[model samples]
Target: MSMNVSEFVWKRLQEWGLHRVYGYPGDGVGGLDVALEKAQGSDGSGMEYVQVRHEEMAAFMASAHAKFAGGVGLCYATSGPGAIHLLNGLYDAKMDNQPVVAIVGQQARTALGAHYQQEVDLVSLFKDVASDYVAIGTVPSQVRHMVDRAVRIAQNKRSVTCIILPNDLQLMAYEDPPLVHGTTHTGVGFPAESKLPEQEGLQAAANVLNEGKKIAILVGAGCLHATDEVIAVADKLGAGIAKALLGKAAVPDDLPYVTGGLGLLGTKPSWDLMQDCDTLLMVGTSFPYSEFLPKPGTARGVQIDIKGDKLSLRYPTEVNLLGDSAVTLKALLPLLEQKTDTSWRNTIKSNVEDWWKVLEERAMHSAEPINPQRVFWELSPRLPENCIVTADSGSVANWYGRDLKFRRGMMGSLSGSLASLGAATPYAVAAKMAYPERVVIGTIGDGAMQMNGMNVMITISKYWKQWSNPHLIIMVLNNRDLNQVTWEERVQLGEGKTESTQSIPDFPYAKYAELIGLKGIFCNDPDKVGAAWDEALGADRPVILEFYTDPNVPPLPPHITLKDAKNFMTMIPDEPELGSVLKNSAKELLSTVLPGR
Candidate 1:
């Protein structure tokens, strides 16, 4: 019996254990819509078609689903703008190394160059973002190859794959029997040992650690798999441990030697320790911010990463070891000496504690209406024990990165240099879908949230609500402006000039939330923030809490010196004293407290 190509594609997806596909409906993908409808009505296999407001959110949701479920996440989109909207979210998945499969519908195959309505060259469009791209021209041969390869690439490399389907291809007749199976399928397994690192590189890394004194170890997202082994190595070497933002959950934050992260929003003691150490060892992290790194003359650095190309991209390194983080660490441990450096570890530990105390004191005393410290305090206690938090780029990133007290097992993700807005909501959706048992919360700036909030709400309505797993919460800090840019402007211009560019028009987020069938709460009084948060968490459905705040509220002080602030301040003719005030305030605060490192 012959069936349409769409039916075969649906069956393949079902065989892969894909229960849900997210995207807005369109004529270009009508065949797929019909096929999915039939499958849903007849099989009752729990496979669902989720209609979202935007394709980007679909991509985001898919990525989050993959991250949480430990499998490939699937998203669908029609040709032209629909496919283009998916680029940003797909890139996020690629950078984070999540397994995502994006099935993009194209215009008729015959109209490839004629520029038909909603026409697009998806192959070229997604080439840069996805690890693999396959255009399915035929039902059995092309669809089968593309589906299998897309799944493999997504699973093996932990990268995204794009499959382009022309509208005409979907309607093509196929004679092959439906290859259906009862058992659920997991993603592709790890490749064979041929791709493993050479033993010589591992031995060389061991030699460097064996000889170095006062070494510091930095971990990144890549170390997630080998976290235990990395911890063991840190224990053996008596090295102080620090993490990049994406690597927050790589190890427990409260470990004796674990200082905080290293970056602009990073803790002061972590930077101090990294700067002063004689030898620095980077494990599975490629930290991009060069400003925070030690000068080439100050310390000898060694980096171990799965990708050799990323070794010295940011800073100069004395040694570059290429291997899987866990595998490489395990190999190096046997050749290392268990050094006794209780005194050295204690010194760094004391410095970290002092820094924490200063931050804590400031947070306790802050009575400002839009106090970031108070917000952190309120949200921290309410977070789920095994919760995952996703922070978008902007002021919210700084607060979550610096202030959030991550318990031993919590996971978090942040947009690094790309710093794209609208990441938080999609990331949260994906995180919740991935770990249905755990809570996932998205903390986004008002400006950032508005950019992608609608699509996120639609995605939640379709998938999460249907599952009755209302574990997703969105906390929007509605300060009514782009505060990060405003701060930069204040540093560059006078306060008067900045005020002109910084004002943001207010939006009625509470009303929008209600219209979307999610809980909506508006918080103007600072005290109400805590109660609003409690209500949102306890709700049986998605909730959006919009807190109206003053845009002029000062953000957490950056980790720069007074002199640097003053020099930058001189450039702006109008706000000369503004820079001085920030610098002096930070200096005064630091001077009263014991210096770390």
Candidate 2:
């Protein structure tokens, strides 16, 4: 049986367990779209064909879906501008190590050398960002090989794979139709028999554990496969635990041993706790923030990681043990003696509680009209226990990171400094698609929400009707201005920079949400904010709660010191001695107004 090249490609996608295909249709790839439609009818597998507004959103959705579901996500785009827009999201997926595959349509094979319409060298454009790139010029020789290679690359490296298909190649017929097999799970097995740790390494780890009075455990996403084992080690060592943001849900945050995260947006207590520890154990996490790490001269460190390169990358390690975290911990457990005194653990736990209490008190007493802390307090309680919250980079993220508490089963994703707008909405869509049963929420700034919120609503209306009732709650902090930019401007200009002068367009977000088939509410009153949140969460369909907030309000970043305060004071000009007085007054106000300063 012979078939067109596009049909064979579609059949292969079906065999790879791709039920949903995300992309925008273009003239160059019209045949492939038709082939997908035909293939759906043949297989009796009603695959979803989702048409997105932008190729970037499509790629983001694919990446998020892959990350949430632990599988391959598929997306498509036309050549030139369409394919170019996908680079940002592709880079994000590559950095985060998610499995995604992008199929891009190219200009005709005949026009390869000539500069034709929508023509660019996509292979070169994606070479650095993607794990593998395959250009399918011939039917039998290239199509199957490329498809097989893409699947393998995505699965093995957990990275993006690009398949470039020319218009002419898609229309050509193959002499032999590609044989498709059902998707089968190639199980991920641990070492057949765990390798016992080297005696030298075990002895070194045992010595550190036995001698150290105060120890801290820093866990990362590398422990996703062995959460229980890592937890056991933390328990055995009686050590305080802190996680990287990527490892947010690695363990339940409510556990007494769990302190918090460490980063620019991380908690201050986590940083203080790390500093106080005499011995720091890096287990399964490669935390990127070098500034928050303990000073090499003061704290002795030990690292247990599968990747040897990450052992001493951030901090100097006295003992670098190269093995799986669970395996290494099990080996060292027997050699360790339990301590009778847990004064260090008790002290750290008390400090963490005090820090949290201070944070909560400030959020409650703050007088700012558009308080971000207040918004987080209201929304955090309304969210489901198993909610999957995705945050976009902005003031809202800073607020949420500090105030929003993750329940035992809740999961969240934040793209650490790749901090692009429009990520939250698409990420919510993908997460909802991946885990239909879990409630998916997006915490976005007004600017970020307006970027891709409508497109995600359309995606939900199109694909998610049959699987489960789509419950998407978008909490938009509508401060009407880019608060981050405003802060930077304030820092540059002495004191009274006219923030109202900034060109921030205020749109009718609630009306816009209704226009896009989502239930919408606008809450201006602070008291009504909680009611609005509750209503949105209880609703069955997609809902957007746009809360109008004070534009002059500020959300404090994680970890600011007295030196940082002095820096702010020094940055201001000494024109009116009153400016210095006002700076001091503002500092005093923040100390009293904000929590956990």
Which candidate number maximizes TM-score? 1
Q: Write the per-residue lDDT of candidate 1 for residues 86-152, one digit (tens) a residue.
A: 8888887887777889998888888878968888778888888884555556444457657767877
Instruction: For candidate 2, write residues 466-485 as lDDT tens digits.
Output: 54757778788887777665
lDDT over C-alpha atoms for residue 390 of model 2? 88
Query: What's each prediction's clash count?
Result: 5, 0
lDDT values, one for every candidate: 0.73, 0.73
Model 1 stretches astray by more than 4 angstroms:
17-19, 40-47, 131-140, 175-190, 193-196, 365-368, 462-464, 492-501, 527-531, 553-558, 561-563, 571-597
Q: Residue 561 in model 2: shift from native, Å? A: 3.9
- Which pairs clash in the backbone of model 1? 64-430, 68-434, 69-434, 494-574, 494-575
- In candidate 1, clashing pairs total 5
TM-score against native, each model: 0.88, 0.87
lDDT assessment of candidate 1: 0.73
